[model samples]
Target chain A: SQELEQSPQSLIVQEGKNLTINCTSSKTLYGLYWYKQKYGEGLIFLMMLQKGGEEKSHEKITAKLDEKKQQSSLHITASQPSHAGIYLCGADWTGATNKLIFGTGTLLAVQP
Target chain B: GAGVSQSPSNKVTEKGKDVELRCDPISGHTALYWYRQSLGQGLEFLIYFQGNSAPDKSGLPSDRFSAERTGGSVSTLTIQRTQQEDSAVYLCASRPDSNEKLFFGSGTQLSVL
Candidate 1:
């Protein structure tokens, strides 16, 4: 079974500060996805990285897949209150079913 | 639908009772998925439905859990003899195909007492 581990299970940052969240997989990553979710709401898609060494950005957030394709990172610059949420990283481990295996998630809190 | 829609945003049922959750995926979507999220926990994959082929129920936690998709559109997830541990938010997601990203529904919060 494949597992995903996220570092800094919870984070608290002051507005305008920058922070990074890491997601590492036990197996090679075929496809990596980043999603943000409110406390009890559905997830909002952030970005997807398939190829190793791929990087994508949206607004102040940027996601990168390491060259080895086993780890990925999400970076937020000038964090705001709206940035506070649970960040999850999902991997497409099974190519056939396309079911995603998600990490425990990193809870981010941006203090004003 | 514009996106995946789940009914009964919240449900409260007695233990040992059965509950059914519904999900209406986006039109033309070929794949639908069910996931569970407990308090302060990550999402757990429950089942996967792709096209007319047999669904992948490998992720189902137990025989008490079952789901079905009709006409490759709407899907229903039923939990029999629900227990207290069954309390969680059941999320439904759908994608156009295997290679596309998924769109999630608001989810149904179930509380088994």
Candidate 2:
């Protein structure tokens, strides 16, 4: 079975600080997605990176996928209080089933 | 446009009881998914439905879990013989297709005591 491992299970940073979260997979990832969940709210889709060595950015957040398709990273530039949430990474499997396996998630807290 | 909506924001039930959670996807969306978020298990995928196609039940943890989608719009997830481990937030999401962006519901917080 495929699995995703996320680093720094919990992080707290002062506002305007930079932070990075990492996700590594034990199996080759076909497509990777990043989501953010606020307290008592549903997850919001952030970005998706498919090809290896691909990079995508939304505002201050940038995500990168490794060429080997085994690892990915999410970087936050000048983090804000709004960036505080539980960040999760998921990988989609190929074929008809096409189920997504999610990581345990990284809890991020950006203080004022 | 309305995003995904779930019913009964919270549920509290005794162990061994059965509970049902409902999800209303956005209009015209063809793909819907169910997921569980527990303290120990984190967030786990449960099942996915795409239009009239057969649902993928491989992610279900046990036989007590089942889900059904009606008219390709609304979905219901039923858990029988619930245990304390079933205490968590059940989230629902829908996408235009299996590989498209997902819009999630606020989720139902289930508590088994």
Candidate 2 wrongly placed segments (more than 4 Å): none
- Of candidate 2 chain B, the 10-residue stretch with the lowest lDDT total is B36-45
TM-score of candidate 2 restricted to chain B?
0.95
Best by DockQ: 1
For each candidate in turn, the interface RMSD (Å) is: 1.7, 2.0
Against the reference, the lDDT scores of all candidates come to 0.92, 0.89
The CAPRI quality class of candidate 1 comes to medium
Against the true structure, what is every candidate's RMSD?
A: 1.3, 1.9
Q: Write the per-residue lDDT of candidate 1 for residues A21-63, one digit (tens) a residue.
A: 9999987888899999988678999999999899999999999
As for model 1, its CA RMSD to the true structure in angstroms is 1.3
Report the lDDT tens digits of candidate 2 across residue range A67-105.
998899999999999999999998875654667778999
Candidate with best TM-score:
1
DockQ of each: 0.68, 0.63
